[model samples]
Target: MKKFICIISAAVACIACESRTYEEISDNTPIAQVVTYNKDVKAIIDANCVSCHSPGPQALTNYSQVKGNINSIIDRISRANGDPQKMPQGGSLSPAQINIITKWKTDGLPEN
Candidate 1:
């Protein structure tokens, strides 16, 4: 019983020590320069997403695949509630990274 109590106490302590990382941005926040597949988009996806979605039949590791799924990509990265899952599952992208991606899409998912 005491061991169980100690484990519960430790779990509570860990939970209490955890901090929220989600940063809220105001509507007026300016976005960065246009992001392109070769320059920024690919790296961000590779670093955060391809691990799970790649080396598979529908890999997100290439331009064609990514271009085909641009809307879904943006939706997932932005952590939209509509998705069945939030990507980079255990972690999250920084607001800047998300901004880069959002801008990339708005800029038409350019190859450059």
Candidate 2:
């Protein structure tokens, strides 16, 4: 009985210590898929950025604007959490969302 309890406790400890890597979990767009502005990046920007990054001179509301500012977009979004220069002001995007933007740029900024 004591050995059974010890084994169960050991199993629980191992489970608790199991680390979850980003690639281990699913993302909105799979890494294997080709990321595009319209398909993956647009949604991420719309949901996390449009509120503050739109309807202004520095708007990111359209594909053209986003593609034009890809460098800055990637820089700002890639900032560490709590960074004063981090984008979207108060919040941050998920790792998957960030990856999508990076991959989009790497993929030559596909519009469709």
Candidate 3:
């Protein structure tokens, strides 16, 4: 009975450790410094997204297109780590890369 109790307790603890809310996860996201399109965000997008989304029908080849679709960009990237329709279809961006884009949108996406 004691062994069973210990195993159950360990299982519950593991579940608790894994069950982080989205707010908790976002709060722990790495913060980037002064993210800008030219200096940062563009590279992240070019490397991860533009391959399939650029110079094509759903283009993100330039600043205007990205800035215009900022909401969708945020949503897609935020969920990309595990979502079925995640952006960058084959792989996931690092937290820092995602943070840079998120910061750019939050900072109003400066041209510099």
Candidate 4:
């Protein structure tokens, strides 16, 4: 009887220690710097998107092209990053790369 009680108590204690879904996990993670067009956006575009999207049907190489088609850029980013129709033909871009493009579009697609 005493062994049973001890086992039950231990089980209850373990169960109590288990994390609850309602408990919020603190996001102490530092916020990453936003990606800008001149610095980060161009690289991502050049590496992943520009092959098919530059000076052709898509054309996302320069600021003018990207800025002019900001909406399309955003749509493609969202789809490629979030949904199933990702760009770059084969693989997906990293979160950091995606963030850079997203930030650039959100920041008015600056020239510099």
Candidate 5:
């Protein structure tokens, strides 16, 4: 019984010591998919990106206007993580959202 308790305790300790990586934590989780201006990306952008990137001759409102500038968006997101030109200005986007955007850009910015 003592040996069994020790083995169980060791197992618990090993499990407790195991740490999940950021990718592991963020991977396979259900997040908004934006394969080209879909609802998920739209919602994120609407709440975070549109305020600064919208269009109107002097503005660039809506997803359609921004969708054409996929490279710029990806660059902005890449630099935004630690820069002032970041989306939403002060708020932070989830890693999952960022990953989705990055993946979308990598996948050729499809309009699906």
Candidate 6:
């Protein structure tokens, strides 16, 4: 009975200690500098999204396209790795990378 109580207590402690999501973590992280499209977001998009989304119905080859699709971009990128609608298809972007893009938007979508 003592062992069972200990195990149940441990299980409850573990269950109560929930980890933060990337968005939550990012929200608490402070940005030391401004985030911009040319310097920050373009590289991430080029490396992750351009190949499939460019020269097609929903292109993201340039700033205008990217800025125009910012809402969808955020939604797709925010999806979990295995989610069918997640951007970058087979993989997920790091929290830092995602944070950079999110910061770019929060910074008013600066091109430079």
Q: In model 1, what are the clashing residue pairs, if there are any?
A: none
Better of 1 and 5 by lDDT: 1
Instruction: List the candidates' TM-scores in order.
Output: 0.67, 0.76, 0.67, 0.58, 0.56, 0.73
Q: Report the error of model 6 at residue 13, Å.
A: 22
lDDT of 5 by residue, 1-112 (tens): 9999999999999999988865577655644544565644667677777676655542436555656766666666666456987655676766777777776666566655
Worst 10 residues of 3 by lDDT: 21-30
In model 1, the Cα lDDT at residue 85 comes to 71
Better of 2 and 5 by TM-score: 2
The list of candidate 1 runs beyond 4 A from truth reads 1-29, 80-84
Give the lowest summed-lDDT range of ten residues in model 2.
21-30
Query: Which prediction has more favorable lDDT, 1 or 3?
Result: 1
**All-Cα superposition RMSD per candidate:** 8.5, 3.0, 5.1, 6.2, 4.7, 4.6
Ordering by lDDT: 6, 2, 1, 3, 4, 5
- Best-performing candidate as measured by TM-score: 2
Over 1-112, each residue of candidate 6 has an lDDT whose tens digit, in order, gives 9999999999999999999876676644657799999999999999999989879879999999999999999999889778999988988887778778888999999999
**How would you encode candidate 4's per-residue C-alpha lDDT over 1-112 as one tens digit per residue?**
9999999999999989977432135333333665567777777778888888857867888877877877766666556444666566666666555556666766666667
lDDT of each: 0.80, 0.87, 0.79, 0.68, 0.66, 0.89
**Clashes per prediction?**
0, 0, 0, 1, 7, 0
Using TM-score as the yardstick, the better of models 4 and 6 is 6
TM-score of candidate 3 relative to the true fold: 0.67
Model 2 over residues 1-112: C-alpha lDDT tens digits? 9999999999999999988865467475658878888888998899888888878889999999999999999999889879999987887777778888999998899998
Candidate 1 global TM-score: 0.67
Q: In model 5, how large is the Cα lDDT of residue 75?
A: 66
- Candidate 4, TM-score vs. the true structure? 0.58
